[model samples]
Target chain A: MLSGEGPIFLQLAQRVAEDIINGTYAEDAGIPSTHDFAIFYRMSPITSAKGITMLVDQGVLYKKRGIGMFVAPGAREHLLAERRAAFRQQHVAPLLHEAELLGIDRDELADMIKEKDPS
Target chain B: MTTAIDIRGVSRRFGRVTALDDVSIAMPEHSLVGLLGRNGAGKTTLMSIIAGQDRASEGRIAVLGHTPFEHGPTLRQIIYVRDNQRYPDDYRLHHVLRIAPAFAPNWDADVADELVDGLRIPAKTPLKKLSRGQLSSVAIVLGLASRAPVTLLDEPYLGLDVTARSLFHTILLREIAAQPRTIVLSTHLIEESASLLDRVVILDHGKVVVDDETEAARDSVVLLSGNTDAVDRVLSGRPVLESHTMGAMTSVTAAGAADDSLRALADELGVQVARATLQDLVSAHGAETPEPLELKKAIRV
Candidate 1:
């Protein structure tokens, strides 16, 4: 699950954020502890702790004193908003870049997207 | 954080050959540090010195604030399971487990039993008759079950299969979390164990090559490959660790992070730029000529 570019902690943080955005963790629901993440991901406890701490700092996750970490309220919406804001730069830009190199015009790209849209 | 194990200017000599040369490392308590290097890179020698099994020809070592050699109290708090640990003649697995608690103050019988079954260590085979992997499993049982505050595992994964290795990783993470301790594990499997380490100490030719947090060490260099001219231009004057060229294609592992400008240059030049993985870093530093140890001070954390 951690096979990605950049530091492991950053990849872990991004994964948790994606999970939150996908509703895997409901708002205010408790998530696994740092140690749990370490064991599950086969990574060091320090690295897991750093990833969780980053989320806590970003208001995406919150600590409940001795209980454990929980998905902060509105965390899903916050992450969704953030992802949506960067969607073009992170996803569409790459798609368009590859399309241009393949000599595919914007109209053809739009047609391909429409044809692939199942719903 | 308190220092768990401290080595200062430690060097080990085997008659005419030098095993370790003026190596200094201070590992803080509860840190999972990776001691890595090629075979005969003095990994075993350094571990032996730290575990009090052998004395350094020069310098000093402190484990838990006291010298480990012949120091009973300090030695009791540390556990070092050698890769080729020997057992008494005709000793069975049960016999070793029975006597282990006598030496380990924090020994946990439940942990030992769990590991025995989990690793599928044969109960009836004599220790002397066990295969290399079986012997490794026995060592792992002792290492984990001891639960000492300071643990040193020298090549614990030797001869282990893929499934066995994964089980070891799971068990190690769980044990450390339940009972936090300082661990220094030496391994030849770099990428396999890289994720489990928060701190990394790489040695080459008996000298510390890179000592830093795992992520920082991986980011300290960038891998570039493509046309020879494009790669060279992107590298510019940066220090190259290791480089290979085939026909017009050149691949270079260069020191320093791939900054934004460098990335832009690489993109324009159609050269691939990526962060160096832990394995890449280790291999590059391993192949590098032995630079003066003084030059390595800049990479130390």
Candidate 2:
């Protein structure tokens, strides 16, 4: 999916992150090379490489000397932490604000969560 | 924090044809600047001269306060990534990764290794065996990991897909934010990369046509749509880059901000005013100059 209107490199970085989450690139598996990505996407190689490098910086992926890159060990945990932080910032706080407006308390929210998931 | 590139009265010519004409520009440090124009607008030639790959027929160029030609220290601080890069036939992706650290003082092996995994590049695959996209990936990795103070990417996104291109934009911004440097990106995808640019330098027929902050350049061109007569009256003696007509309606893109009086007059005439986009500005200027590709073809014939 197209990211928000911004630099092309950022959009590419998001796509790679999404791909990791979606399992298009499995943990510990090598992703497509920059040249391959460029040819597949008809983009410049440098552009494709930018996306890969961003993932590396985020610790979602790690490199192997003389070998191709692999999904870093504990990458899923790292991603989960990041996603949880984002969820709280992007969704939970706003949700809490609306709950306050509706006069819902901690017990009511707990009850709703319990009803949604018994286990 | 000084200017990354400084050019004064720079000119280049190929026989009777002028590739760059008395051009002068100072690239600000730690900013992403877009070098834009139609094909053969001297974008490549100017970049080449600045990178020290080619010499300017006249004038002077200094990168990092040193003349770039054969200047080892200065050259190392600049990375020029282009589509036409050549590699030895026997060389493989591994070779590039291996030697990158030696040349790039700030090279991050971990970043390179992570890229290799994410990109799935074959370590043993020869350069000739790799696909076009694979070759481009090599260039991308080198450019980013090099961490040069002055990084010039010439159409670096040519062979990438939408997803890959988006990733590139993200990484470039994050990296630059973490480690600020001067970056000059040349591309035809104006609208896509417009926001990333701090400033834009547009060339027309080897001459600098538009050089301004990206926002200011966008602000200088105003688009107005209204009655043809009223539009014509306001546009008279003003610099109008382009105009379109449909029956009694006319849309004129005039250079400079619309004054209060002109805005009021336009409103009285039922004219709609809007900001002109960078693409619109470039298209309007490009139309005024001879197409660079056409000129090259003519010279060839």
Candidate 3:
């Protein structure tokens, strides 16, 4: 599923974070070990560990002294808060930038967004 | 990182041709390295020198802190398996199975049996009687089952079909995860085996051109595309690895040209920008690239 989209580990981190948001892994539940992740993805264990480590650093997952990694409490909330903030930069900014380039005013842009809005 | 294999100023000359010229590479222990290069780029020569199959004409090599030459204890811990392995004309697969364990001190007979069965290789068949693909399978079984400290595989999946190649990859990675080791897999099927490598070493004209972590290697190049003049203006200052022009649209692979400034230029000049893959990097580095290989390409041994 990873096709040279930046680094493999960061891509893997994104997938794991997405799983947390989608409720595939419950908060406080232990995620797959690096070996399991490597086997499942058919990649190197070293690569998977890097991704897991990234999550650990981000407070998305916590590691016990000897035990494996577990989903942090409120990880979903943390991720949602992070993604919502990113939504403005990733999805909102491009729309606004294009609207400005096309000379579309504020009300017209809002109207266009509402017309095509899924909600 | 602890170095498992350290080679310095290694050179191998066959007649007038300098197969390996002042090649030096140090592989960290428990790392899977992909040794990649075009034909006659000295990958095989370098592997042979490190594995002690052939001696370097000049320079030094150390495996596990000891020189590997004349099949000593240091060499015993390393297994070199190539796609087209040759055995005595009289030896059969049965004989090889009986004797291979003696060479690999850490050999696992059960793993060998499982892989042989998994690959559906006929153990009763003579070594000379097996087909090319079957021979490749036999080599892979030995390489995996050996579980050696250092494993050198030179396109061991050359003739394997999609399923067989996938099986080899699964078995190889599983074994490594269970017991990490230094493995250098040399192959021309760059993209197919790209993900399996932790570190990648690229050779061109018998020299180590690029050696870096696989992630960092892929991130070093960027693709710029769009109208010819727009893309050209955006790519002007960058070192263009390879570029293609179809009609008025131009696609260029630029090395070390990935930055916010470049992206802004590409956008302002009406060009598109994207990341470059390892395959793109391989073609960009050196050597004339042939037509792009299919997703599933078999290297003929």
Please state the interface RMSD for every predicted structure, separated by commas. 0.7, 9.4, 1.0
Better of 2 and 3 by TM-score: 3
Off by over 4 Å in 1: A97-112, A115-119, B288-301
Please give the range of 10 consecutive residues that has the lowest summed lDDT in model 1 chain A: A110-119
Residue B275 of model 1 has an lDDT of 83
How many angstroms is the interface RMSD of candidate 3?
1.0
Considering every candidate listed, which one attains the maximal TM-score?
1
List, residue by residue over B1-301, the lDDT tens digit for candidate 1.
Answer: 8989899999988999999999999998999999998888889899888899999999989999999999999999989989988788899999989999999999999999998998999999888988898999999999999999999999999999888899899989999999999999999998899889999999999999888999998888999999877887898878888877666777878889889999999999999998888999988888865332223333442
Please tell me which model should have the higher DockQ, number 1 or number 3: 1
User: What Cα-based lDDT does every candidate model obtain?
Assistant: 0.90, 0.77, 0.84
Task: Pick the winner on lDDT between candidates 1 and 2.
Answer: 1
Per-residue lDDT value at B170 in model 3: 84
Ranking by TM-score: 1, 3, 2
lDDT per residue (tens digit) for residues B220-249 in model 2? 778888876677666555677777666667
lDDT of 3 by residue, A79-98 (tens): 99999999999999998998
For model 2, the superposed segments whose C-alpha errors exceed 4 Å read: A1-119, B119-125, B129-132, B289-301
Clashing pairs in 1: none
lDDT of 1: 0.90
Chain A TM-score of each candidate structure, as shown: 0.87, 0.71, 0.89
